[model samples]
Target chain A: MPGPKIGRRGALAAGLALPFIRPAIAQTAEPYVMGSLFPMSGPSAEFGEAFTRGAQVALQHIAADNLLRRPVRLQSEDSQALPQPSVVGMNKLISVDRAHWVLVSWTATSKAVAPIGDRAKTIMVNGGAVGPDLAGLSPYFWNVIALAHLEVQVMVPFLVRQRNARRVALIYVDDPLGDGILGQLRGTLPRHGGELVGSFSVPRAAQQFGPVVARVRQTRPDAVYVASFGAQNAQIVKALRDNGVTQTICSYSAFGIDSLRTMPEAEGALFTSQKLDLTGAHALTSRFATDFRARFGQPPLVYHANYYNAAYLFGLLAKQVETAGGTVNGDSLRAAMLATRKFDLVGGEGEFDEQGNMLTQMQVNEIRGQQFVAIG
Target chain B: MTAFLLNLATLAAISGILASTLNFIVGYAGIFSVAHAVFFGLGAYGGAQVALLLVPDPFLACFVAALIAGGLSLCLALPALRVRGEYFVAASLGLQMVAATLFAELKPLTGGIGGLVGIPRPEIFGTVVPVLPLALAALALILFLTARLQRGAFGRTLQSIRDADSAAEALGKNVNAAKTLAVAFACAGAGVAGALYALHLSFINVESFTLDQSIQIMAMVIIGGTGTLWGPLVGAIMLLSLPAVLSFIPFIPPTEVGAVQQIIYGLAMTLLMIFRPAGLVGDQTKGRSTS
Candidate 1:
């Protein structure tokens, strides 16, 4: 005899019953494992430390209320700001730890980890990496922060409209992140009635920007757009100022408190960044900032907010999956995340496009005294 | 666990090939070339482009990459052969910087800072071999070929030239030709490794192949005991596997793991240098200074 009448009727019955059964099974405290790869001990160690603290704070927040039915566990690795280490970390996370979700920061590390995430069918949330290459790169990868080009798009218009910058000079670190910003500025400045007079790339470790500063000075552009970050940003700004080329200086979010502290001369510099005012408005932001300060004993960097947003997003996705009576695996969570139209994160009300790029507003901030005061 | 092991094994295999290639130059031909990774980058970029734009076949792409790397190494060997010792090293270092600049500037071919991604995985005879096993097979083949070369007359000529190039020239040996051939062969090995690495990672950038990588390869040869057949393999295994093993230790915070691993690695290398200057497997009588 044939199969015992297990046709459409039985299949439909099983399909209908699966949803009811799944939630009960999922509610049984199945451990949700998250693996994070950060540059915890390399050139970008400061940012990595901030990212770790963000993850910790996010986890603590989740654990407080038991946000999901399952207990969440985080297994992290230090990527050392290098591709090889990031790859190794990704492999261990995917193959050994069996992490359901992976978080990565930094352009190089994210680029290195994206292919692995695609192959392993795991969802990778890029918290801080904003390289232009990440746009439409992978369905498995989601960039929580705005793409570099998008940030430049926002910054350049502000420069043209508010700053009234016509001729621009570009100075960037010779790396993917810097290159991405420069590429965007070149394409964007022309459309905004601005001309790129001079463009120069300094080596990543070059402390002496004398020649570069001299070259930029010769051009006498309306404003100088710099793409260097951290200590490099301070160094470049100081070099430019010391050379007496006092054209209105502007940069990407790279001009942070660290850079400002190092080069007090950069007090009047203008830059565009994701609105990171912790005490300004959003309750979540205020709570996160307060808790972070209490725990880490220092103000959270903008990168910390990015990672904190990632962890929060992960929880939101897991909650959505649970509510929909679905298994909390990579595929399901990714689908849930993509389907989400908006999320109230610490940064702001953020939305993601189909390409997993977060669409958020960037505030133009001016360094006033020792703090970054939002101008626009 | 299996995937982690496979990844570690693949990394070791790639490192082993690089170490072996460096050994051919520094151990056999006595050329202090620090531009080895430049050739490796060329192979990776060339193979990646070939597979991406020219041919879909990974093996053919790898072969083309090897040929390109070998040819490029031969060209470098012509000028490099004029110098010796530390001077040669400086020349190689300069060459490396130039190659890096080219890799960064030639955005059309190399993809510049964005790098070439979406490289197709290796497929053989309608079957896709797992990258780990393919890497291991490549390692085995390279080791076998290296061993065979060491046993032959070519290897003897290389040793003589390494020891005393002027003396070898006086004895009617075509010293220039031998140096060029040695560089070509060694670079081919690096090319194969690079190709395999590109295929395995399915992504490559200028950052992966740098002076740092060349230095790391040289360190592997030194630590494993150069001039011996098994030395590079041992060194590659040790260097590649140590970090993975250390990562498993409990109580160390994840944030501090990388720094701790680096400290341990540095300490191990320092102690080895202090205790065994000739290296773990190198002959004490044939010290580095003697050559």
Candidate 2:
């Protein structure tokens, strides 16, 4: 220990030689800046935090897989899921941060920023907003998840033909998500031989559904379909049951919300969700499930899976761009995406259409004794 | 960064016009209506319809929007302004709620919650005027007009009615007529502001005209100082810029910025009321009763 001790002059010499000894330290590639505009505060902050968590885990897997030699840096802007903050935050993300590729959520935020992103030629990958209008928003804008029309289109036949629920009542939220469902139903139900007997719309912020429930009950629908999200879906079900409506109530993936296992009102409800069949010998989804569970001590939700897939796709695309002797940017990445329209994701495999929109398989499932038992 | 600042400045300008008009009604006219955003909504929808259906002429759109909002102001003014202060506030609140519902439900006009999009930029003389410059010019015009209105006989009549309606009425001032006219004029300014807002954002929706938005506009007037020409403008700039300014501080954590902003706004509002009741830029020499 005494022999190893260095004086100030020796220490200075060693410090001076360090950079030359490890020259590659100075040659590391610059980090790729990935921008994520989300509701980092306000009512939707939980979803934002969860999306960030998925991305964090994705970085670990991206490194383990050696998808890209260069590191990726995630930059976030709090949109608060509103127009004003969304516009300002989007401009900051594009102009100041210089993140050519951004992940955006919320229907309003997507619509507000679509024209701006298109003007700047920024690649905005939306995985959360389900608005149908987002389908044809911009050439630069792409959707990684199924839009509302697809979900509702797939859901209607399952309710009508499979369940024999011809006369259906709808309780929908009055925002984009609900409007998306509403727009689709206008065409979908009549085509599927199902009639919409009663349709009730509650504001996005409506907490009390007594008047709505009373109206819906009066219609005496054979089944009730709730085009809603979060706690509202469960609240609507509870309101229907409390008002003595014995209708076969159902919804999309929202029926399997986190609190559904504990809520008796959500029992017997069927939903449509995308699930990867991890039955192969070395399935990527099975491995991801194991690793995600080991890391977070909980199974990943659909949102977590979606965000993880979004980040994982970026890594794959970056590798493709670099391999093709092009810089990884919005245009190059978008080109890579279009060239390879199909992707194998941890959630499931998907194929992007000519419109840069992807649709996942929606498997029907039912809740039996708080367990989500798949039907098909 | 410059573009970001420009975005914020455009927002501030739109908010400046809104706050200035609210200041006229609440501060000068002695009407504490909380439904100022309804007029703003009316103007926004009116202007949006005009620009989308007719031409993108900034002047024509704003003028039509202002006239529409001014006429509708009578609905709130005749019923609410003649009542007590608290009842006027309640009436304004109800108006905001009803207007929000109407904006959302009137699918043919307001786009049914998805909002009206693809609105072109302000075109003047067949040349497109940039949104930032247009917004700032509108704010200047509103402030100048407010100054002239607050200083002349119009201002005296409002002040006299505000100080004591009976005394003003005894002196042959038409209290109801003056109050109604003041509301219409103030609402017209709000309409112009709303038109600029629609043009600036290039999108309009019911969310922008909710009770929450009304409260924010009211807060701008109260925090800046009521009854003063520059008070609401200053408040608009300060409140709109608070989040950006806080991000520059080295000690504050990024996650705590929003919370810290709310805390600062609440504290500033409380301290201003207790120590400087007139507001940061409120007029103190007007002999206006504070209590």
Candidate 3:
């Protein structure tokens, strides 16, 4: 009886020491390193800020739920939305930080850094870039956002069918994103029985849309397809209305409801958006939206959802690798990701195709007086 | 860390070549030409095209690109040289704008806004030249050539022209020809740098060759010590490496790193200007003359 009593006392003492011992064991496991490259400053800071915050929130949730086999650490670099700086940032992330995964945010940066990723044999996830060229570029490259071509593919039919647009004039910003959308529209519009009347390319930072609007008006098209985004999109819309050109204005998802609020003329304009309105989303998406707003003090942009989905996918893949008795690495993680048939994300349930492009539904929303109402 | 350092070194070498070219115009020749980035773009687009279409050899492509850039510089020099001082600066700025527009509009050649992608990596003797060693070699070659030029009569002529163009012309120096040669040589260096840059990054766009880039290069030259041969290299290294170093600091969040880096860079430049107007390695005696 005395021996049994002493054993029970020893067991109690061991249990008392378990809290201190558990962390020590946990500390021994190597952490997963994720390098995030964002346009944290410069023209695209809004998107970059959203991406960083979304990823942070995702990481927090993963940690809270103990979703990963090992602790995960994220290190971020600023790309500044330029190619040269982007390359430098990528190099630092891969070589200096020895990151296992890199999340890139822009098309030019993703393209510029692709060679590096291929050479380093590191997994790169693109949460924001949607260049058409990115499809099938590298085995290690994964795109979480819908491709720009896909958005245009969805838009052209909407213009012809839903909006009854016949002759469409194109006014797009002169950049890779704008150019990709224009190319897609040119090829798809004729098939839809829509005539391409006139097109004008303006600089990304062009403030003077008077000349561009004048040229667009000369065509006298039934609808003007604007492939601009951000503040420039607002400027173009204002210029179009000011010039008395009242053709139905359709745009790529360049301006959100907030951006359009500043330009009252943008009301009733049709645009394609990858982001769902959180108020009417699935329960999971609504919860994510609520959590994001609480954390960031603002509603999440589409880019935020993309990055959050990426982080969650990464966590699941890492857990799968661990469960299979395999180390989490580029190769194993890639295999795990490829094997996954579907993912439930903040945007919606989707899957990655063979080319690593995400297959997700985009919403065709119409701006109705300071709000984007989903039409089709 | 090694690979990152190599990347940084490669960028620094490319930047050194560009800043040195600027130094030749602003420091030695006192032209203050802002069209250097235009010539740089010419070299990149032209050289990449040649490598992709004509020659598989990157070295030959780079040489041809430099020659093409040098030839193009004469076009700018002809009209720009007709003016003097501030007028010359204005003329170069106009040329810069024209070149930028051409880069954006020449869709067939430059790939327009989509930019030229999938640029083949440079190879030599059936082996791809690792970007790091190639970049270091390029730096060595550029430094050697710059040093040779500085020691030769061309350097003295440029210096004399910078001091007093009238006196140089009076002494039988063809001021116009000297200026033209100087611009051509400087632009060739910029072109060579651009070729390497395009190859290393494997992509190029009009955005990379904007007026802002030209101003950044000029800042490097001024910060490094314009007249000295090694000053541009030092400045290039400092400016290019500053961000990487700041990125390692733990206190600054990644979101705010860029803004903080810019502030630190600006503060450093201001302090350096106040303390060492002649530059870190510039000879006080050979400092920029007001005249």
Candidate 4:
């Protein structure tokens, strides 16, 4: 049977529709994989829920808001908050799940996984782990959060100018993040005419701070900086108060853990963090809080917001790449990110340097009655 | 998929090597020492330092690691001479704890908690070797040597000492020397495994070689059947690959994966102990320890 011949007008209409149909098919390609490597099983498992929910919420937004031309899925592995496990998780994320872009947190885990990410040529976006060592860990690596170096740059001068504290004694955890902060304070303090009187490294298992407290007292500094995190901050601070060695205690945003902030020991302690107003007011943050609470039945924490920004940023970057005749992978997305350095994150507007480190306005805050209050 | 499988294989082989060497001590010599991870960490630091400061030759790294770990084995060997059975176990545990602390504090050489990161991939004659092959070859060599040693006279002497310590000594068996030699050789083998572990992971930290790691190696030896040659290999493969397999299951929630994996692994171990007390691959008649 002979097919009916199309008229000239019909033939012209079909030809014009070809371009639209081809692009529509292309836009429906297989969903890309976004991966998260976090401590989901070990001591730091508490961070896992927020990290996972944050990314999932962002993916939900990407779909609801039509943020990307194609769909994307999230795959995750447990890092156990250690380097060795992180290597294994990172391998599975890259090789098995085919995650070309990975989100990493936890300072040591981030550092450990970077080599694998580099080897696989995956774009690794770090939303947590503010270690200065991660600043340029790999060409494929970039930070969605400010490194501790930036916090130190904004903080030490504030301490010197506001409190007139010149000699700063450091009590830091014996880990990469703490080491990075210490390195920054070493250079940052000196640059501002301040001296690092003594720096004591504390292992993760340390409990009795009597020796550390005595050593810090011996340094006779005007201010003490606690570069440690979590419950240890409270212990060190309590020991300092108990010893009657009260100077303006300083730290970074890692001090925001709920346990540390609520304690009487952390009273009057100051910390520098990326400019984020915790109030549920800002447009993006408010929307995110609503979405998070709706989905996860709780308000988001600081880390959740950071990871949400990471996931949303990925979708936006992928969209931009697709619009510009590229696919979402290490090279393509990285070039797109470098080109578009200024992104409107869920918290606020964030800027990135050539090294792909997202820079934010700095805010100094104090723990006042279990709340983080901006200290001007 | 290929890279992931290769990584898994490399890890499994490293664990297998550790299990086999541990079997040589715990199974063959009846040395119930729990400080095997100390040797692993010593070797890891040794190999990592060499890779970071010098060339990343796998052979050179292995050799240096063996010497470093073997030299340190005197701590355990001397204690083994004075202690018997459970006393030696306690001494070995103390060593593991002390070694872990040292590994974390030796910042100049070990890089402290951050560890020797970015350890270049191992190379032989300026050629970058694939990690799985290197690990697999190492595993094969350890297994072969173990089989050969088991049939030799030295194996019989150790067997006699394990089954009847005082009688073997009265028979002019040079008991102390045999124990010392067994501990050193077993530790050296563990050091070799550590070298390959560092090479495979391309990073090493104090966390990787902890008391938990020693317990894991012990479990592999016990679950796989200590006296049998392929026992450790079976146990290592089971433990190392369980999580990977569980991850593939569609019904399990992503957040519940690790917890579920632990339950399954524990359940498997319990079931194995109940069903096959000698081990999955062990001969019940010969694998028992009278010492």
Separate clash counts for every candidate: 0, 0, 0, 0
Q: Which parts of model 2 are misplaced by more than 4 Å?
A: A1-30, A161-164, A175-180, A190-193, A254-256, A259-262, A276-282, A367-373, B246-277, B283-291
Off by over 4 Å in 1: A1-30, A174-180, A190-194, A203-207, A229-231, A257-262, B284-291
- Candidate 1, residues B158-178: lDDT per residue as tens digits? 999988888999998988888
lDDT per residue as tens, model 1, A311-331 = 888898899999899988878
Question: Which one wins by TM-score: 3 or 4?
Answer: 3
Candidate 1 at B71: error in angstroms? 0.5
Rank the candidate models, highest TM-score first: 1, 3, 4, 2
Query: lDDT score, residue A13, model 3?
Result: 82
Off by over 4 Å in 4: A1-29, A163-167, A190-197, A217-223, A234-248, A262-264, A278-282, B251-256, B284-291
Error of 2 at A242 (Å): 2.3
Q: Per-residue CA lDDT of candidate 4, range A160-254, in tens?
A: 99889999999999887788878888888888999999999898778789998899999899999988765577788899999888788888877
lDDT for model 4, on a 0 to 1 scale? Answer: 0.83
Q: Model 3 scores what on Cα lDDT?
A: 0.81
Candidate achieving the largest lDDT: 4
Per-residue lDDT tens digits for candidate 3, residues B147-221, read 787789988888898888889989999889888988898898889888888888888888899898888888889
DockQ of 1: 0.28
**For residue A145, what is the lDDT in candidate 3?**
79
lDDT of 1 at B194: 86
